[model samples]
Target: MPNGPTRYDTVLLGSPVWNVLRPPMIMSTFTEALDFRGKTVIPITTRAMSGLGTAERDYTASCPGATLAEGLAVRGEEVSKAEAEVQTWLKRIGLPPR
Candidate 1:
């Protein structure tokens, strides 16, 4: 794992929903690499048709002791038009667009 801060006040986890699951890499990163205790976790997922699936749930499980915020799911085809939506979500989570 890359060396960096082990603790954070906020964490943004983005993943592509695949087959009703988060990608394996994301799972590994959260479950095996990071420590999220007491942090605010925001799960964001993009899906073609599978929807958000269990991305949020899985992330919550992986980051035990963390505070999970409302998650955001964007349709893959709508990504290009989702800037406003993304900004809104960011704002909702207390991280206004910069």
Candidate 2:
């Protein structure tokens, strides 16, 4: 069996965009299998250029009633330098910096 589950108010879902628009098929499968209702769902993306792509729409559809928070999209090569940006995003979403 897996470890004990922890409760949370927010979720960060991440994926690398495929073909400059869509997230990988695995993302769709993963999201569809989860229950995100009433939570703050935020999408994180590692991209070459196309921003958050269709993550916002995809999550909105898959996670019914979830509060869609601002998503974070970082350059694929710049993930290591995204700490500050991520912190800011968390704050903006009413979460304390971790």
Whole-model lDDT values for every prediction: 0.74, 0.84
Candidate 2, residue 38: CA error in Å?
1.3
| Cα-based lDDT at residue 76, candidate 1 | 83
Off by over 4 Å in 2: 1-6
Model 2 scores worst on lDDT over the 10 consecutive residues at: 1-10
lDDT of 1 by residue, 1-98 (tens): 24322555877777788775665565646554666777787877888776667876777777788788888889988999999998898888778696
- lDDT winner among the candidates? 2
| lDDT: worst 10-residue window of model 1 | 1-10
Q: What shift in Å separates residue 87 of candidate 1 from its native position after superposition?
A: 1.5
**Where does candidate 2 clash, by residue pair?**
none
Model 2 lDDT per residue over 24-89, tens place: 988887777777767888899999989999999998998787889999899999999999998998
